[model samples]
Target: MAFAGMLNDEDVRAAVKACQVPGSFDYKLFFTRVGLSARADVQGQRVFNILDRDQSGFIEEEELKLFLQNFSLGA
Candidate 1:
C-alpha cells in the first residue's frame, strides 16, 4: 500500500491540476503551514484563509515560496 503521505500528495497534485485551488502552493507546502498531515479538504480550508494573508484566497506565488522556506515540516 502506498504511504498515507503519498496519497495525500496525489490528492493534492490532482487538486492542483484541476485548478480547484489557486496559487502554486501545492499540497505539501500547504500541509506544513497549517500543521496538517492529510489533505482533509473541507477540514483544511479553515486555515487556508490565514495563509492567504491578504484575504485574497489566492496566495501570491512569491509569498508561498517564502512561507515554505520558513516552515520545517517533518519527514
Candidate 2:
C-alpha cells in the first residue's frame, strides 16, 4: 500500500482517552486519524502532489482527477 496506516481506530480511541484523561494529544499522531499522508500519513499528499503540477506547494481546484483515468506508472 502507498499509505502508512500506522494509526488505527484503536489508536484514535486511545488518543481521545489520553486527551481527556491525560490532557495531551499524541503530537506525532494528530494527522494520522484524519487521513492526510502518502507514505507516512495518507493518500492526500500524493493526490495533492499529482495535482500540484508546477511544484508550487499548493493545489488548485481545477486540476482534479482527470489524469487518473489514464494513469500509468513511470510516465
Candidate 3:
C-alpha cells in the first residue's frame, strides 16, 4: 500500500490495532485514517487487509465468510 503523501504505515497499524479490542472497531476512524469515503468505496483487497487484523496479509476463509455474513452478503 502506497501512502503517496496520504498516510504512513504507522497510521494503518494504529487503526488496525485499535480494532484489536473486543467490539472496539471504529469504522469511522479507520476509514478516515485510510482516506476512504466509505466502506462501499473500499476495494476488496483493502477490505480484506483491514479485516485481517493481525497484519498477516492473508484473510482466512472463515474470516471472509463472517465478514460477508456481517454485510448480509450471505456468502
Candidate with maximal TM-score: 1
lDDT of each: 0.48, 0.43, 0.55
Model 1 steric clash pairs: none
Tens digits of lDDT, candidate 1, 1-75: 212333344443443444434454456654553346554665456445545767787877655554443432211
Candidate structures ordered by TM-score, highest first: 1, 3, 2
Backbone clashes, each candidate? 0, 2, 0
Worst 10-residue lDDT window, candidate 1:
66-75
Could you tell me the lDDT of residue 14 within candidate 2? 45
Q: Using Cα atoms with residue i matched to residue i, what is each candidate's TM-score against the true structure? A: 0.38, 0.29, 0.37
Estimate the overall C-alpha local distance difference test score of candidate 2: 0.43
Q: Is candidate 2 or candidate 3 better by lDDT?
A: 3
**Candidate 3 or 1, higher lDDT:** 3
TM-score, model 1 to reference = 0.38
TM-score of 3: 0.37
